[model samples]
Target: MSHPAAELIARSNRLGSDARNTNYAGGNTSAAGTETDPVTGQDVELLWVKGSGGDLGTLRQEGLAVLRLDRMRALVDVYPGVEREDEMVEAFDYCLHGKGGAAPSIDTAMHGLVDAAHVDHLHPDSGIALATAADGAALTRECFGDRVVWVPWRRPGFQLGLDIAEIKQQNPQAIGCVLGGHGITAWGATSAECEENSLMIIRTAEQFIAARTAELEAQGTHPFGPIRDEYAALPEAERRAKAAALAPVIRGLASTDAPQLGHFTDSEVVLDFLAREKLAPLAELGTSCPDHFLRTKVKPLVVDLPADAPVEEVVARLTELHQAYREDYAAYYERHATPDSPALRGADPAIVLVPGVGMFSFGRTKQTARVAGEFYINAINVMRGAEAISTYTPIEESEKFRIEYWALEEAKLQRMPRPKPLATRVALVTGGASGIGKATAERLAAEGACVVVADLDLGKAQAVAEELGGADVAIGVQTDVTSEAQVQEAIAAAALAFGGVDLVVNNAGLSLSKSLLETTVKDWDLQHEVMARGSFLVAREAARVMIAQGLGGDIIYISSKNSVFAGPNNIAYSATKADQAHQVRLLAAELGEHGIRVNGINPDGVVRGSGIFAGGWGAQRAKVYGVDESELGQYYAGRTLLKKEVLPEHVAAAVFALTGPDLVQTTGLHVPVDSGVAAAFLR
Candidate 1:
């Protein structure tokens, strides 16, 4: 049977994948219970955000940051309108970044205001189709009708809140609203419901666009056209210079707390498209949708930096341009504000463009930029299509500002709180001082588990255990789990300290570089002793204690991907891990009678700054593999489906699943935490 968490994850994945496949840069899911707002000390559960810059496939619980809604509402009510907006943005950003969590999505306020159990935001291609058109609101209304409400495009931040509030007051039962020329937003009492609505909106938009495009094509009109020579001849040097100058300015506008900056310049096609005169009028018309304003911004900033300008000079000019823009923005705000209006909340720009360089969408978070980039790319295509049909007509400028600056829209910035899933568990991990083991230890502790760290490095183990600061909860047990006596002592100490052993994670193992043919008996025995014998010894001993207490517990073996897949030089290590996997199955089969569960979590090469794949897998080892040192990690990462290195914490989550109530009926199972590398090798 599938675990509930696993089922939720599987379904969540489908939603996230569909969003990205449709051209959205990213998507997120958030949760909350009644929580006290950190800023206002009010009683309300702040929803948890999945955060920016994260892909759903690898996202774990830690990625979701909490925000206290009551506190947020208090801040909104207590502070000046302008100050409240800034505080909301700051508080949300702080909850995301300052709390050492992934940055929350820029539209967190939108999710908060929905007063729903779950929320999801995305920029689907179909949605972008109508959003990029001049008659987006009319088109959406004709298609979605009462199912969706249309919010005019706003720049985002404070303006977005203002717009959303207006819509809510008008339609109390509205499921969600689409921002003209921006993306779509959906909310529900559960994650499944939210996802369903999101899909409904996207599918509806797609079907509408498909039919409309087909009709146009039948009439001998195409949506997009090929780029002409005149539009494509922009110099690359000018583009490069433009990106160099804009990086810092873009970074500044995105976050006040984050001083770090990295720039990814655009492709030639993107730069060429931005250089067109049609770009200005199209941008003034508004975004493909309003929510997209938080991602791509209402429009891209056109830089006129010359190709011959020095990189430094170009950067300086970009900074100056942003300053001028901000001053002009203040003037625009003063000109438009009424007694009821709130001033601008954040400095994030819609999009920044250098004459020859590509565009950058500055938002409160990376997810914002990511989604905006997706919308921008789609919008570019829309413009090309529009040129094919007639110059792309988009929503009006004033409406865009209204949506961007909506009060209710800005309210989406708050986040909700969630309970730790592993709050009462006690975890004992072997090899917990360094590498994958250390990372796993940290993860378990962070999830509210009492962790006993056992390692060969007594000092490191003691330090980590002590740092955890729960004398009764965390302890350092220096023991080579390969020795039955040592393993028993560690198990005994855990029972004595934490009351009982709830989990035993056998993660102690080491790698050797010798090939199967060249392997020595000594090396073979060493691997067997630590990987196979040690795991069995620890599991049996822990199982005995768990059985006595009459509380079924979890015994997890940290196996390796090599256990299932054969490779040239990993014979000794692979054979031992393979045995460990079998041991787990046997333990689960036998110990289930005793109410003890056994499982395994197999991990791929967990190399990132870890002992396993560090130093190019070490120069000496690389020489034996007959590959360059630099190619070692890449060679491994390249083999994975997602091209992402499997981290130790990824394996820890598998351990959590194997041990948690979610997998109560599951036993003797092996979960491959590899990035589909096993399947790749099998194929």
Candidate 2:
């Protein structure tokens, strides 16, 4: 019942959904067939190849660029040698069978040259491991015998297409070809045969790795070191803090002139790789294959964690290391670049490794950074597998340079859309698990800020992060604002997860309503600890990271209308909030010199979704006003001029306004979000 092209798309989607075969949109697929032209009523050969930037996992008919096979095949005669990449691209555009308007994959030529009706190409980790190993050709021969051809490395373009065609001519019986330091390609007369052949190659490579791993383990020869018990034994919170402490320093060093977001990974595999004794040498050897050159640099920057050192000392050492890294990278680029190569870009290392801590991946966006981290994690596994059998080998530096500087690859990077207003910025919100804090975090993320949801309840914080789009948009950190250690750790986590802290929302507070005579010393202490003292500790720590980054930032506090208008039996809550109001004024004056803006939002009667209104607090407050619990929301709404009950989202909008460009020049100001409280209006 499906169209012929639909079958090819379904087959492609199946292969792409498995990350072991491809990540994001890293693979390509094509189907060739004969279709009658509506205009001429003559049968014409057509090739449907995956379009540029199209994800195979979500591929549809429209996602494939339909090209005239006869026209594309004629390009081999037009450009016989390594033709200018731009010229070949122009030629491919001229061969479009229809006005699909989607750019074809750069591998279109290679697909056209294969003498088959269906073709599939993928960058499977298992295949890359075998292809990049020192004895890759011999291993290929051993695995598939004469059924597969082995092709040496060449930059992907017209020349690579010719090389593949020549291999096929020489070995007509081969089912597929293993590209050295690249990937695998399989072709057949039908989609089923193509899929089966691709799977066969992948399964064969997986079997080879498994058997090799077993043999090494039996001989007591291990490729990776034992995981660090010290790091593994600590609680998750402590482990996160320890690793986060180095985030800013590494991010600062890894940054180029262009801005980037830095992401940290402390997963089981990342930590184990970091703890390896030979980390520096192993990381410097290069990426597992040339395909990774676009995302991760040829080598990662290796540094010591300096766990016991003071923050200042760590910064100084990391600064020196960063300087040396840039110098070395520029030297390497100079040594290998050709005279006709495009100007160098992205000289900074994409990955940074710290022994006993974790690995940091950098990218233009959080998702890209996370993807780079995932790729490196795969690289670690493949490198281990290759080394378990023999020495881990990677492509030579010259080949790495060619791929990294390839014009077609550079075009992909240039095509990315401009960043959002708050792109690469980080925001940390206290008590971010619910109410105003949660709303503020969500808003910041919607505008492209990486948000840290800090709360006393770890589970609640994590749930909020997951709701806000997981680690790429939000990372939940369990932070007891009353404790100095937890406060410092939370800030460190934000800096490590992103590059640095650019926004801080001091919104973590609790309310206690009791007559002055009935208020216990314990209740008073708790109120001040979470409100006044807590705000001070969080603000100070956030200020430290912001100043270290030397970038101007904004800090907004969620104060209360009761700060100025006193209410009976609300001394504990009102007094603590008043203290925070004055503290904001003082902090504004002090932090302004460092280009940090300090402001406050005084919101009133925000009953809906308010934690203060939950757990019988609203009923208790209504009782004091001689009203039933059912009428509490209306009672508060009627007190305001707008006759509208202030919601948490309304307060979140005010926070955005103060931190956005509209208030770029405004500081030391308090914005009200109470729907017009006449008594609390600023004079």
User: What are the Cα lDDT values of the candidates?
Assistant: 0.64, 0.81
TM-score of predicted structure 1: 0.40
Off by over 4 Å in 1: 1-13, 19-28, 33-46, 52-58, 69-79, 82-84, 91-106, 158-173, 225-375, 382-683
Candidate 1: tens digits of C-alpha lDDT, residues 1-683 = 44323433554567766543245435556655554446666665556666655566555666666665665544445445644565556566544322636566556676666566676666665665565566667776888887788877655555465567567657867777776555677767666687788788887766666676678778875454333333343465544433433343455443332211122437654666655655556655545455455456556655555445566676667667767766665665666666766667644455666555566654322334445555676667656543442346565655556655666545554343343555545578999887777777777777767788998778888888887764634778898978898887787556444434667889988767678788899989988998888888888777765654444578888887777887667788889988998898788889888777888887887766465556333564567667787676676678788887676778877777777658788888888888888552422
> lDDT of model 1 at residue 529?
92
Give candidate 2's whole-model lDDT.
0.81
Instruction: Using TM-score, give the best candidate's number.
Output: 2
Give the clashing residue pairs of candidate 2, or none: none
Error of 2 at 309 (Å): 7.8
Reference-based lDDT, residue 144, model 1: 88
Please list the Cα RMSD from the true structure of every candidate, rounded to 1 decimal place.
21.5, 3.8
lDDT of 2 by residue, 476-517 (tens): 999999999999878887877786788999999887778899
Residue 492's C-alpha lDDT in candidate 1? 58
